[model samples]
Target chain A: MDRVRVVGRRILCGILLSAWVLLPASGWGAPLAPLPAPKAQKPAQAELGRRLFFDPRMSGDGGISCATCHMPAKGWGDGQALSAGYPGSKYFRNAQTLLNAAYNKRVFWDGRLSGADLPTLVRDHLTEAHFMLVDGRLFPERLKQVPAYVKMFKEAYGGEPSFGGSLKAISAFLHTIASRNVPFDKFLKGDKKAISAEAQKGLALFRGKAGCAACHNGALLSDGGFHALGVPENEQIFQDPLRHITFRRFNKVIGVPNFMNLRADPGLYVVTKEEGDRGKFRTPTLREVAKTAPYMHNGALATLEDVVAFYDKGGGSGPNKSPRLKPLGLSADERNALVAFLKSLSGEAVSAKEPKIPDYEIRKLGDN
Target chain B: MDRVRVVGRRILCGILLSAWVLLPASGWGAPLAPLPAPKAQKPAQAELGRRLFFDPRMSGDGGISCATCHMPAKGWGDGQALSAGYPGSKYFRNAQTLLNAAYNKRVFWDGRLSGADLPTLVRDHLTEAHFMLVDGRLFPERLKQVPAYVKMFKEAYGGEPSFGGSLKAISAFLHTIASRNVPFDKFLKGDKKAISAEAQKGLALFRGKAGCAACHNGALLSDGGFHALGVPENEQIFQDPLRHITFRRFNKVIGVPNFMNLRADPGLYVVTKEEGDRGKFRTPTLREVAKTAPYMHNGALATLEDVVAFYDKGGGSGPNKSPRLKPLGLSADERNALVAFLKSLSGEAVSAKEPKIPDYEIRKLGDN
Candidate 1:
């Protein structure tokens, strides 16, 4: 049965390659993120969360916001290298797309913190410690001080022993952020004709010899762990404006330095302070990576092909790079097959609303 | 024929009285704006104008905005006792609803200016002179300094001689603010059954015994002139915070403000500055007035019935009131008929969209 399956997969790849050569270039770009099933949520909670999401007053500066980074129209990620903070800050990390963030066990790249439900994140952004932008700024504090928010938070979470109007409200909202089943998923569900034959062939390679399932797997196509794939040296291409990595030790516990390495983003290493963890970055979900271009933690690789080819060549050379970082030695056909598989990872498009702060708040923010 | 019309008008009044008794009090105090329309427009110029209208960046403090007063869902007027301005202002005059300003020949209560159009008005708001809130620290100048505005303005309006950018863009946009045809207009166009029988009778009474047609007439139900039916005397109501009206006095020979009364809004007196013009506010269009409650320039009356009753008693007693003002001695039935007719003036609702600023701008403002 396994032998037959492998043959079937190879046949599928052949059929897909022929069809892809005949297809248009536009057909190969990022597909829409799939729509997640509607969460079985209390209408009141969802409505409250929705209201809070749209309210600009929730942000620190009364201007920077979740919607600002995770624009629905722009595939839940602002199409920028790095997100801006209050007063136009060039934030260090790219705003990760928020498509299936509800599925994430650990949030942010470093994984220093976990179990940060929704409202906690929301309130923390408003607090002085987590987000410093709102500390002295007049806007976010104003929202926190508003009578309406207090009333609303009390209603949503119910003030008392266990609840404090934090993560409960936000998590209820994030619960709605599930991966939308894509054309590939549809094809996987016996709708063999939904996706082109090329995609099917790519899927075979992804599940078979390409060894992608070694890291990216499951419905989200991610294990949410870190790996150091041997791609090009980080310092070779892009100028390292903010140094994000430093090697503290060698083989014992190689960890990237937290003091801003100019080469590559130090990522999870800074948290563990382990030596072997050097250059190890979180394995981001492949769910919506097509639309989120300039891939990798530092946005080093410009295309999926670059990523796939890097893997095809078994990652860039590095002392602490994972054993899984070896090249797959793929043929052009196989490389194309891998590309097709990555393309299949794109999900259904999620609708996003543009943010609108009330005119009163707009007046208060002193912004456009 | 005239006699028959008079008899029909009386019968119409009778029917309106019955309907008024039938309709529950549920709708009495609630606003009765027009029903919404279904359509989408992608005109860049109009979109730009909309952005400017909602953006506080155009104001002195980067705060005050056209939308601050003329809210879309709330009958194009802020539903407040009086408008708020820089440093928490409490304007004496009500925020006049912009239900159908595109159809009016004159703008504002005092009718000081005309022909400048909507974009010009935005420009006037932006300028250092006149009703300039931009300099008052209401809206900062950073919004105007953005490179995108220059590009958008140039695209919307050809530069230089035409005074391109926000002004020209908004002017083009205002051209689209035409009021939708209402049921009454449909009835007027030979669809006798379009309006209820009571409304028809109410319309007749409005034209005859009620004498509302003297000021509220034509397609817009306004003559775009001023008359002082006694409104309560209040020293506080003199200043127009919206700056929708400015008292300019003109010498007939010089075509400019030659003389002006300090204590008077003087409607058209801003131009002529005649003694007779004192206290004469512009005749506002009755179209869509149902949706904009708290009638008159001060929003004193809470309902259409209150408005009819006020008219029945002529007005609150005041000096320099119009000579045409007098107690109509309207029967309860006749007053109800008048209210019905006024309700009929409500037009089809226009769609409103919340403006979206780019994420870069949102983030630049701050996290809030």
Candidate 2:
């Protein structure tokens, strides 16, 4: 009998540990996760990364810097559905934000990318990503020309003569993109009057009937898990394997073009290449999404109202739809309150005038 | 004998009281004029004025707002010798900062536009003096086409509906354009370490050897006086009046081609029309002149060094030059230190983005 009691105690401890691990990644279908408390200590790497993030020298043509796309003013994402690519090339996907991305295990809409390591991700974004081409060439060759980048990279990485210097420096910057203090955050911390009455009503609806909290729980508003939401499949997944590499893992076709001449995006089928995984996409963090307009994966919706209405209507009747998809009846006041709470997520951001680039003499490629 | 002694005692008492009355304003300058100590009372009118001051609707064209010239970001002035005139017009003088203007008895370089009130000045700027024009027409007329202005005007002023509401509303705003809390202000308030050691040294030089305090003194940094600093007299002032009128005031000539070419400026002569007034401009407040670059009335010098150098060389020696203009020999370090101290004079300013016009329908002109 004593031996049996000891075994039961051990089993209880294991279960508790497992639950804690699963909390952040998936709480039913909730996407929100509580942010870690900010450290009072100022990390030098974060400061360096912040400078690089704002500086335009990281880009090839100097016209499209990192800040141009991942703008702090517009919720770390350009307000555009897809950012205008290097110089003027059109991109296919909306610019994903970098807010609290350090907490993320997997990055991007399809979960084809994973790992919280900054350097690897920065390198992939600058080189492998199709969006950041400069002067009709890749960023690596063009970045070599800017003297400021050379100096910054050297300072950030002990003057190392490699692109790794830049990657490390930029990743150091990304760690600082933490969510600001929000009303909802305050509400959970015992301030019953923190959120407005309307928002409180909406929150109740979210946790109860709407089941939004099922997928949008925690502080960051992401479960960090994927769902097959019955979105239409794109045929482009088969034709353009390079772009569809991530979606094909779900064995789903990329979305076809809309009748209105809009590009129909394959939400996640391009990554997994599994029939069951078709239209499966990672839940997005709702923090600051109000400012990043033209919502959804393709930016098909113009307003937050449209997004809420779409979710309420149970999405498109496409194949491999999640069982979670259902109509959520909500009043107009409830919807408005939800939007109001979403808007309150944004706060005054720190801004500084663009720094003047110093004049520098660069040696020709062969001169060295 | 008793009557005589009583009379003498009364006389003595009267004399003592009279001395107390005359001592503060005259002996200590206007800063000690028995006025109430600068209180922390937040003036609602000043707040209203601040809103109007930031509003772009006051300008003729929506584009050429007050911020276009007296920029908050670039040191309370556009970083130009002279501000570009509205649409296609010539600017005759350098843009003057509004800092501490409330303390001045005289206004403009020529000291010909002095008023005890702010509304008159703002009106003059809006209607006549270098206003923003669209297709060679005043901005108020253009505003008449928009319905929004009518509502804004109504809300801002209590008067019955009209095209040009209350000019006093503008004056209320200008009254709030105080110099920022600079390091010197901190120093004056007993924080000796607020200013750097180098700046302290520069301040000593300014007060002692340079004798800058003699003219540029008191709280507002001016004695509300005018002086001829031996700048070049306009040739057209004494030569041709009509042909020079085009040069003297806003005209199409300055805007044609580049606005930076040989500008036809009349300086102080436009105001006084006296030979002695040709180079006699007002002793402007140096409150934040470090930010308002292209120093001097005509914007002849591009930097503060050029300004100090001009003063060090007794200004450009010419007719009607002030006797105060005399050469002073200083080391390069001393000059740079002076610039540093001057830059520290700039205080907190309003940001450009916060005061944008709300989307409102244009009011029809005939509605009033």
> Cα RMSDs of all predictions?
22.8, 24.9
lDDT score of residue B356 within candidate 1:
69
lDDT of 2 by residue, A28-125 (tens): 65333335543222354555566556655454323356788777777677887555544312344567777766656678777667745767777666
User: Looking at candidate 2, what is the lDDT of residue A147?
Assistant: 65
Q: Model 1, range B1-368, lDDT digits (tens) per residue? A: 75376457645644544422222112222122232221223387777777777765554323456777778777888876555433222344577777666545667666755733655555654542222233221122233234455456556654411233556556655655556778775665457787777787887777666667766665466767778877664344433312211212112122434222234334455556576776678888787788888777766677899988988888776547766557899888888877887787776776568666532121121111
Place model 2 in a CAPRI quality band.
incorrect
- Candidate 2 Cα outliers beyond 4 Å, as residue runs: A1-33, A38-43, A55-57, A60-62, A134-154, A230-264, A350-353, A363-368, B1-368
| Interface RMSD (Å), every candidate | 16.9, 21.8
- In the order shown, the chain A TM-scores of the predictions are 0.72, 0.75
Worst 10 residues of 2 chain B by lDDT: B32-41
Indicate the worst ten consecutive residues by lDDT in candidate 1 chain A.
A243-252
